[model samples]
Target: MDFRFQSASPASWADVAADALVVVVTSQTQRKLEGALATLLKEAVAQGDFEFKAGRTLYMHRAAGVKAVRLVWVAAADESPKAARAAFAAAFGALKQGGTRHVAVAAAWEAGWQPAQAEALAAAAAEAAYVYRHTKPSAPKPAAWTKITVLGEKAEAKGVQEGLTRGAAISAGVTFARELANRPGNHCTPTVLAEEARALAEEYGLKVEVLDRKAVEKLGMGAFLAVARGSEEPLRFIVLRYDGAPRSKAPIVLVGKGITFDTGGISIKPAAEMDEMKFDMGGAASVLGTFRAIAELKPKLNLVGLIPACENMPDGKAVKPGDVVTSLSGQTIEILNTDAEGRLILCDALTYAERFKPAAVIDIATLTGACVIALGHHRSGLFSPDDELAAALQASGDKALDPCWRMPLDEEYDEALKSNFADVANVGGRAAGSVTAAMFLRKFTGKYRWAHLDIAGSAWKGGPAKGATGRPVPLLTHYLLDTAAAPSRA
Candidate 1:
């Protein structure tokens, strides 16, 4: 969908041509409404038909005074960007299944209203309208929702326009990630993922390199290759570079764990919901998603993405429990359980990131169920020894409304990975599983400033709303933008 800003008076809202005119309401909303719309809202308030409570909504079809086919009034918690996002999303979601093709959104015009509010609205609308139909041949056709016009003062066009552009890009990235992650294991294998990366490279002029098994083997990625042995599908070590800045500048490196379908190998999970394991590559999806957005924005900073894509299945050739493998960092790992495969691939990828001489390295993975238990579905688990890096990520997550809860990464947690045979153990028992997983990856990241995002829960929902959340993409994008806008480091 496309979004733009236009000047429209409150009285003129009655004459606007649209399928739906969404009026955003805050605590001070009543006083801002004008003409027939004001009278309509006042009557609704007096008759107890509507209130300015958050999430409360009122929908009218061809209301007596409005030219639009429908009018949607949604109450935001406040004028804040986050609230606006949720409220706008709710409004659009109400119309997603309907015939509403064009929407006109108007909020109280304030002198100091940040464009972030407009950005929030654009993102929320796009996300709400997204419907997956790639593999569903019998599924209904895509929604006709096309253009979104934000009613604003003419003086505020430039800033709001920029925000809308960014929001659209972010939403597109989120949608792309969701589509890739939503695909079944058979449709979205490691090789298919590499093809998708190449497609993105062609479209955006990015530098993409997909390493086959032989290439990965040549690179000495035993930990990564071990995970691919169980599946018939080939493994791909995909690398993406966005040269927005000069080669003289060091780039931020993103490492993603791409377990296409995890059957737990020798240690299989319960059969009840093993199908959900297709989402094990949520991290890889987010990496690709963030790349999609940054490549579009072309922020003034170089960035690189690494995805160790494969499947974890049970086979005669599969790496078994108690198997020891050498990582790209030359460190040996004792695989206590084949189920702990995300870290195995990620360890090798983290080591590869060191070659970039990166400003910072962040590895995202659905590495631990413990994280789901710890943070629930609300926040991703963030673990970092570097306070500055962790703080920056935390701030970015907050700004993007994709929050992360920082976990402990003290030396005490590292002790859990003690191995009797190898240098480190793959599984750190049951206690503090998330932290131990981070600690295991930290072994390979010692060469650079690194952080870890354990997106076990935040990656996707499990029950009724089972789909990829396209997290960390927003957080990572915000972090990149902030990093670019920040003063150059000496």
Candidate 2:
């Protein structure tokens, strides 16, 4: 999608050229708009054609005194940041039904608009315009709308433009992640995901490497390989590097659990809603998504992405409960439950990240349904031993509106992983399942400042709106952008 900011005064808003014009009312109650349309909006409220309630909107097609073919009036309580985001979201939701290819938005709080408001508007437009039709070839084509114009005060044009650029980049990354995660398991295997990474590297000039099973065996990634034994599809350990800074600078490394399709391997999940297991790779998708955004924005910092891509399926060769496997770090893990496989793959990947000599490393995964129970579907569960890293991530999530809640990682939780035969048990008992899973990965992250994001709750929706949310992409991107602006770590 293309985004632009136009400095249009209130009086000239009605004359802005576009297929549709969306006007936001900052006043608590609906009142007159600017110019000839001032009384027109008041009359709209008086006639009950439009309600004065927040988020209420009125849509008019070929309305009188409007140069545009269509006009939309949306109500907001105020021009506050929260209101701005909600108002734009409502405006775009209303526009979704129309074929407005070129949209003109005349905003009120928009007069004093900041970058946040601009970013909100652009991101909302992308959300409204998105339609998934990749696997469904016969699905209807998306709307022809390709351009979004936000009418802002002349004084704030530069800031608003900057915001639009960021929003466009973020939304694009989110869309990419969603598309990859939405694919069926057959079409989106580990090999396919590696190819996607290779394509991204080629397009963005990032260094890319795809390691096959034999290559992985050489590195002694026993835990990662044990999970891949059940699947007929070959596994691929993907490594991506974006070097935008000097080699001496320690990069921020991101480790993503790449369970392409999880059937729980021998400890197969219940038949109910099993289809959603295909989304087990949401963490990997988010990493790819964040990379795309960073590549476009070109933040002045080095970034490394590691994905231990594979599938967990039931087979005679599958690793079973009580089996012990050694990790790349040479730590042995007893598989108490084969279903608890995300941490198994992630643990090796986390060990692999140590080679980067990263300043900080974060691992993203759809690690546990326990996380979904703890945080519900609203926030991803964050676990970190480092307080500063935890605080930075939480703040970043808040700023981007992709919120996360930090869960306790106290040493007491580490007791759950105590193993009878190995250094640790892959699955702890039912109590504090999510925390224990984080604890398991925490074992391998001893060499770096590490944080873990359990995205099971926020990664995808299970019902009618069932699909990937492309979360953490927004959160991660914002975090990296903030890091790039700060002084280099010593």
Candidate 3:
């Protein structure tokens, strides 16, 4: 949505919006806005149906003398911008970011907003809501809602609602991502996953392409197919594309691992807490959810999502330890362990990423237990070769309250993954398991500025028997928006 300020008479502005916030300062109170107020710097006790209770909100309809929407930040006579923005964000469910309040005033219009701008407002607002819900340690002061008044005509109401609607859409996407991450492997199989993706695409306008066993084989995704061979259900590779951006620009590529169920193949994962393996596909779900947001907001940034969906079960056809498989990139991998299947699927997906030649490639997976050990459940591990891409993503996460910790991709770890039988080994031993896993995938990224997010701890957090955590959706969506809005770089 295009956001701008206008200097119009109260009569003209009132003609635009039916209900508007009026500012008025009364008595000994400082400057404040009252409902469709008469005075610009008057402080008056909040009255009418719109009461200003501590930590709650009320709305007001347009009244005489009101020129534009005014948000009343009721603080203890003296409140800082931080406190005011917090209250304001909570009241309207807006993300606390620069230009949000100003942009939102105009964005509230019922129409005249581009899909991208509309979605950005929603994404930002949803992010704010998520952060508010997660923050703790309340202060001993009264809270107040920040009010926003619409000053445009009825035509602008659509734009305003559109901004709010976008926020809801992003929330839905994040919720879905969290759900997939939290589900157990027994319930989230390949068939069930295919059903989920198809349902979302059918419900939304997004396009989905699910590649079955034969199709996966045709693509020469042997590494991914090998991981699924052990399972009874056939493997599926799902591709979702949303083209809201210009076709000339390279689309943002999101690759996720959709391991419906992982039993560590023939190498076999430990029996303890195998149930959590269901969330192994958290990466795929995140990409799916992100695509959902893109489709809803219709951002002018082309997005392509790839999911190498499968299960790593230990059965007759399951690829065993010491097995050799060729990735789509033609690089061979020596399977040192069946439990290290995430890298196998990711390698081929990275190779598949070559098809799109994306401006950047981001892949998320619950690939290692060591990552959880390192960062715990508070943050996901972010490993990226590009500083610019990494910084943009980190900033996005900060705004969304989905924080991440940057992990080192030390060249020293690469030696642990060397394989005599193939170009690389899937497992890099016990020490630095997470870093080694990243190194294994880095070999496939080639020249692309790639980021590998290890969501193992963030995806599922409980005791030994914890459920899926459904993490990183908001962060990814935020990053996409930031990248889309940034100026094109060479």
| Clashing residue pairs, backbone N/CA/C < 3 A, model 2 | 33-38, 101-145
223-324 per-residue lDDT for model 2 (tens digits):
999999999999999999999999998999999889999999999999999999999999999999999999999989999999999999999899999999
Candidate 2 lands at a TM-score of 0.97
- After superposing candidate 1 on the true structure, give the runs of residues whose Cα lies further than 4 Å from its correct spot: 109-113, 487-490
**Deviation from native of the Cα of residue 161 in model 3, angstroms:** 6.7
Error of 2 at 379 (Å): 0.8
> What TM-score does model 3 achieve against the real structure?
0.70
- 10 residues in a row with least lDDT, candidate 1: 107-116
- Superposed model 3: Cα runs more than 4 Å off: 1-166, 184-186, 463-467, 487-490
Which digits, one per residue and each the tens of the lDDT, describe model 1 over residues 16-102? 998899998876766878888888888988999988898888898989889999999899888888888889888887787788889
